[model samples]
Target chain A: MLLYCKDLTKKFGEITAVNRLSFDVKAQEIFGIAGPNGAGKTTLYNLITGVYKGIGEINFDGSEINNLDPHRICHKGIARTFQIPQLATSLSAYHNIKIAAHFGNEKNRVDKKVIDDVIAFNGLRDKQGIVADKLSLIDKKLTMVAAAMATQPKMLMFDEPMAGLSPLEIRHLMDLFKKINEERGLTIVIIEHFMKVLTELADRLMILENGAKLCIGPPLEVTQDKRVIESYLGNCYAESK
Target chain B: MGHGGNLMKIKKDLGVLLAVYGLLALLPIFFHNNMSLMNILIISLIWAVVAGSWDLIMGFAGIFTFGQIAFLVIGGYSSVIFCKLFGISPWFGFLIGGIVAGGAGILVGLPCLKLKGAYVALVTFAVHMILEPFLKSDIGRAIGTGGAQGILTVPPLKIGSYVYNAMEPTPWFYTLLIISFIAFFIIYKVVHSMWGYSFIALRDSELFAQSVGVNAFKYKLIVFGISAALTGMIGGVYANYVGMLSTRILGLDLFLILMVMLVLGGMGRFPGALLGAFITMFISESLRYFDTYRLIIFGLLVMVLVIKMPQGIIGLIFPLGKAGIIERTILHFREKKAKKAEMIT
Candidate 1:
């Protein structure tokens, strides 16, 4: 396993956001996580990335990372994109990418080649000079992805990468993800809502309901499972099929 | 085309910055032996150095410290006490003062590392105010702080035979001008470096910065150390220049003046700190003729400026919203002309 989480749980006052969740992601696999709103998919990502403290054992590339700081976790080679596109708004896209490149390097150096390659790969070459806040939503998302990729992580997580994108934009991102996975052999974890996206892209799928695991299996098997269908993949999804 | 224009704009801005600094460096030549004017200039330069430091931590790094003046106080006392009791040269005292102040900065920054926004500001203000009473105690007096009466007969900078005394403020002015220039330049370099980019990134979004591997507490401490060190050095120089160190410096008035100057000149810009310092000093000195009314008038002025021109004087002059005023102006005209030519074609 490239990444492993065993018995991870997060609680907020009276509510448990993630409860006894355990999963193992093999190397170079595109793992999809799906659930209804408030199912703690993002909370799980937070726990894995050390953004939130949770009762868990998180091992990334054979190292314990549950107690590591977010930056240290990033240095340990895990990078992620936010659902809302957290970017340095006033700075140019190139500068935003450059900051990440300098910081994420184990040698503490900025690699110009990596910055340019990431920008070009993400199709932000033309908008590289534009400030992130000024870029369109698609471009902002691209910039965020480019920034995450600049960290040179062994594993990358996307939090709803298709949330607000157009159909064409979603297709473009899917292609980019496939390209990245195939070309670089980096493990990918995607938290998404679109059933079709998950079925098409992910090698294995994990479904959650109210922060507890509902099912974990092949994408098709998990989607067709009775509990997943009843709670998340509603009758509409089954009828569309 | 846009990339080419941005490169041109950056080059133009650099040239303009050099020109501005060059002009300021020539101030001694014009003022010559006008001791009173030179005294004002010296004090203004000191404030500029200190305020510029504040700008780096508070404005750029988003630390929002209100107790920056405390570093100056610590620095001034360290130098003056060392000069008086230990017979150290004022020149060496300057270096010691910076180190001492930087140490104090680390102490102050540790508690502040976990704080954010107004809480940081309030805590810093508390630290700034807390030191005054401690210094006024009998132990503080015995330690050469001179209690509430302040330290007297602090020796001026002496090299071989020459003493930069108040009788001739020319040497003092030149010394302060150079020191202030160095402080500004160092800060400029820091804000422009990769570290500076991380500062801005953290300022904008701490989560984003952390996710990308920019350690928040680490960078904040570095900025605080640099800022406090610079300000402390200025304080040490100011003590020698005036030949006095006082508890009066711990007052809210001095700290407010620093904030007003920073806000009025625009925070986050080095030139803004420079302009704010020089202009505020000039206005305060000119209004010193009014005696007691001087402070009230200054307060009103700050209020009006804060309300009317929150971007400060730098914002008004450099409406382009970038760093270099002169270069931004040139770029503005060049772009306009380019657009006009395009229309004609």
Candidate 2:
């Protein structure tokens, strides 16, 4: 396992954002987590990446990283992407990746190479110098991916990589995700709402409701589980679809 | 095509920047040795340093702080105090003052790290105003700030044959130029580097910055420390120029004026800060000639610039909207790539 969440729990004052949830994410697996809005998908990502404190052991690559600072965790080679593109609007795409490259690796710290690689990876060479703010939605998403890639992380967690992208853009992103996992040998964990997208890309899947885990297993089984469907919809039906 | 695009960008930006810098070099020669104008240039250059530091946080990093002048007072007063009371050299005193002020700036930045948007501006303003009275007290006065009466005759630091306290005012003008040039260069390098990207990253989206391995709070603290330190250094220069410490009320006022200059010039630009400072100083100084309507005329310029020239003089002089050459070139690539993909598929 590259990343493990053992009975993770988080509360904002009185409102629990993520209930005690346990999951072991294997190395090089594309783990998919699905839930309704406010189901704590983002909160889960935040807890693991050290955005907020949460109860539960988060072990990344055999070490407990629960209390680690975000940059420290990043140093441990775990990275994530926001649901919405959060690019440095005043900077160029190449410059954006260089930020990650600064803390990336001694060998890869050469910004010029890192930037060129990211530009090639995202197919953004021509737009490399463009300010991130001016980028279109798809391009912005690509910049986010490029930045994460620049970190050379062991595992990459994504928060809704397809939120506002059109179907065509989603297809483009899915292909990129596949290439990143297969070619780069990067482990991927993604929290996304689109079931079709999840089923197509994810090696395994988990379902959540109001911060509590509904079910966890292979993509086929989790989606087919009665409680999982119920948690997603309103009620559970006994018969399988 | 890539080569062509790069050449085009160089031509678009570098040529204009060089020309403007050239004009700035010539301005002093034409000022007719007017002491008021020299004073304006010196003050404007100092303001430029402050604005550039502010831009490092505000324009580039998107951390809008308005308490920059607090660092100035801290630097000025701390240096003056250390020099007069502790009998320290003004040279070392400058460094100590800057560090002390930077330390306070870091403390102020701590609360600001948790805040978003305009809250930083509000809290920084609070920091500026809160430090005022304490700076004016008897103990503060006793430390050589001279209370409301102000300090006088602090000997300038000397390096061999050069006594920085030369009375001709040319030395002060040169000092302003040297400091502004050095500070602006540093700012430019910072803004051009990967660290600059980290600043911009946090600025664009603190949330996003977190996702991409950036420790937002720590980065913010670092920026605040550096910005405060630079601001303090500029403050040291300002104090030494006049050889005294003045009222603390000017702290918040200077902070606002810096912001106004940055906004008037172009936020997030290196030369823009310098340009804004010069313009603001020139206009405000030039306004004094009117005597009666000076304040009114000054008020009108602010209004006009704020409304008509939102990006300031840089926007007016340079055809920067056309800097979108990269975007258009990228679009062209997209077209070509699409065609290639079509053929392959």
Candidate 3:
């Protein structure tokens, strides 16, 4: 397994966001997660990357990694993106990528070659000089993904990656993500609102509502589940006919 | 990729800083009123150092600070008491003051690591409230800081042949500028390192910063600690410059001015800090002819900058200054690589 979580749970005051959630993911597979808002989908991603303190055992590459700091988690070869892209507004796109690359690469490990390759891969070459705050929403998304790529993590999580993207921009992002998965063989875990993006990209999918798993299987099985349809995917989602 | 060019670039930067410091050192020789110019230079240097340090956590690290003055007071009074009452040198007292100040900052910053933005601002305000009255009360005043009367005539910052005093503003200014340069050098190297990037990254988003493997809490304390130490030391020297310590008199106006300096220059910007500090000093001095309303005019100047140029007046001219540091990194890399290629081929 690339990543595994067991009995993961989080609570604030009296309310629980993640309730003893557990799941396993395969290496090099694009995993998908779907849920209503506040279903703990993003919270789950936060837990795995060491952002939130939670009651859970999270293991990556067969080693326990629960209490480690976020930097250590990144150092351990896992990286993620937020639902709202958080690029350094003061940094140009290239420098943003370089900043991330510095963390993953040891001293003297990064030079022009490494930075150039990541820049090319993310298709941010032209926008490299643009400060992140000035980028259009879609470019901001690319910058976030580019920064994550700098770490060269074995696995990358995307929380609502398609949020606020235009349809044409969505197609570009979809194509970009597919290329990253197929060409680089990077394991991807994505929490998304755009059903079509997730179904097209993810090999395996999980559905959640109210912080509990409704089902897990291939895209077809998980989306077709009666529990998921009633709880999240509306009955009219697939067939208006 | 060439070593020669990169080495040249470093040497050039160092030379420029040294030249500026050298010119400042000579100002006392030409001035008939060495007293006033000397004080100006020393305080400017001190402000430069504290402001530079302030830029580290507040600018590069992206944590806004208002409690900087509180830390300065902690360094000044705490150490001065050890000297006057127990017969210790203000020198040793300054060290203790720095540690105490830094320790306090770490304590305060640790709690603040969890509460960000405006919340951090509130925490700093609370700290000032706690520190101010404690300094004014009998326990504070009785210790020979003289309560509201303040401490009078402390020995100055001295090393070897150079003695800083009322007539030696030139010497004092040079001393401060040198210290300021050292502080700047350390900060410059730090901001470019891996840890520096982590600070910037964390500033953008804690969740994102964490995901990239930067411990926001630990780094926050590190920045807070360093800022406190630097501010405390500057505070120690600052006490000597006045030759009398009245917490209310020395700190009240300067504290707000420093913030205005920080903001009118740039909030989390580097060169912005320098520009802010320089502008405040220049305008405040130009208004010296205006007397009591000088401060009023200074306040007005800060308002003008904030109103018209929110990123700072400098931001209007050098908006990319914060982001342009990246160009240096790339230029450095290219030069180094070329040097390696030359050696092999």
Candidate 4:
């Protein structure tokens, strides 16, 4: 397993954002998570990336990674992209990626070839010189992906990558995610709202509701699970399936 | 742009800065006899360093610190106290002062690491507010702060038996010019370095920057220390040149004027603070005839300038496009004259 978590829990005062979540992601597998709003999908990503301190043990590759800072976790080869596409907005897209390439890796020196290859791979070479704020939504998301990829992580996480994207744009992003997984041979854990996207791309899927796991299995079986359908998928999705 | 392109740009910027310094170097030749003008030039150089350092921290690093004046006062008082107590050269005292002030900067930066925008400003400003009372307290008096009267007998800087005094302003001017040049050189290098990119990244989004392996607290604290050390070094020089120290330096008047320099020059634009310092100093000196009205007039001028040119003088001069305001104005007149000539033909 590349990442293993047991009883991971986070709370804000009286409200528990993530509760008793235990999961393991094998190397080179695409794991998908689907949930409704405020169901602790993002909160799980935060716990793994060390953005928030929580109860429980998170083991990555053999050693426990609980209580590590975000930068330290990143150096340990875990990289994530945010839902809103956080970037240095005033800087050029190239510079934004350059920052990650320079600082994200354990090596003290930045490899120009790595930055160039990632930009080309992400199809951001044309718009790389433009400031991030000026880029189109899809281009911004691609730049964020390029930055995350530049870190050369062992595992990558995406939080609602398809949000605010057109159907055509979402298709392109789905293809990009496949290319990143198959071509790079890196583990991926994606939290997405689109059931079709998850059913198509994910090797294994998990459904979450009320900050706890509702079901975990193959996408077809999990989608058909009575509890998952009742709590998250709803009768409409089940009937459509 | 690639790393090579960035290096080329940095080289060009350094050359331009060198040219500006070269021009200032020749001024002592023409204005050696004018004591008042020479004094203005010297003081401008000192404040330029302070304002430039402030720009580095606040504008570039995105750390909104209002305790620059506090650092300046600390450096001045510490340098004088060190010299008087240890009977050491003022040169050694300057180094001591910078180290002490840098330590204080790190101390202030620790609590500020967890703070956001306006809260950081408030915490730093609190340091500024607390300093005067601390310096006037019984502990301050025992520590040779001279209590309310302040330090009156500060030693002038000496080099190989040559003394730098106000009576002979040219030597002091050149010395400060060299110091200011070195300080700015450091600022330029920092802005163009990898550390600079990290600071900009952290400033934009702390959480994202951290996820990308940038340590926000470490970078912010480092910048705070570097900026304070540079400002403190200049403050030490100012103390020696003036040959006195007082709490009056902590007054809001000096602080506001320094801020005006930053606003007049585009904050975040390199070398803009240098130009702003010189121009503001010239304007302030020229308005001396107005007495108390000078401040009111200055205030009004700043308001008009801020509204008219929000990016400041550098933005107007070297806009992103090919033509600046001056070039555009010249082109406009040339086109009008050609139109008139065509009609006559």
Q: Pick the candidate with the highest DockQ.
A: 1
Q: Residue A147: error of model 2 in Å?
A: 1.3
Please, what are the lDDT tens digits per residue for candidate 2 over residues A88-202?
Answer: 7766676677777775553435566766787798898877777777788889888888988888789998889899889999999999999999999999999998887888899
Chain B vs. true chain B: TM-score per candidate? 0.89, 0.82, 0.80, 0.91
Looking at model 1, residue A183 earns an lDDT score of 95
- Regarding lDDT, does 2 or 4 come out ahead? 4
lDDT of 3 at B20: 54
State each model's CA lDDT, in order: 0.86, 0.77, 0.76, 0.88
Q: What is the TM-score of each candidate against the true structure?
A: 0.93, 0.87, 0.83, 0.93
DockQ of each: 0.61, 0.41, 0.31, 0.53
Docking quality category of candidate 1 according to DockQ thresholds: medium
TM-score, structure 2 vs. true:
0.87
lDDT of 2 by residue, B1-345 (tens): 132443454354455455655676777777736777777777888888888788898888888888888888788777777777777777787787779878988999999988987899899988777676666787766656676777766757766678875346576776577667777777776765657777878877776666666777777898898888888877777787777777743643454466668877787755688788887776666656787676555556667777887767666654343633455678899999999999999
Clashes of each: 0, 0, 13, 0
Model 4 spans > 4 angstroms off: B1-12, B289-308, B320-345
- Of 2 and 4, the candidate ranking higher by TM-score: 4
| Angstrom error at residue B59, model 4 | 0.6
Model 2 local distance difference test score: 0.77
Output DockQ, candidate 2: 0.41
- Please provide, for model 1 over A1-241, each residue's C-alpha lDDT reduced to its tens digit, 9 standing for 90 to 100: 9999999999999999999998899999999999999999999999999899999899999999988989999999999999998987767888889889999876789888998899889988788888778789999889988999999999999999998999999999999999989998989999999988889999999999889999998998998898998999898888788
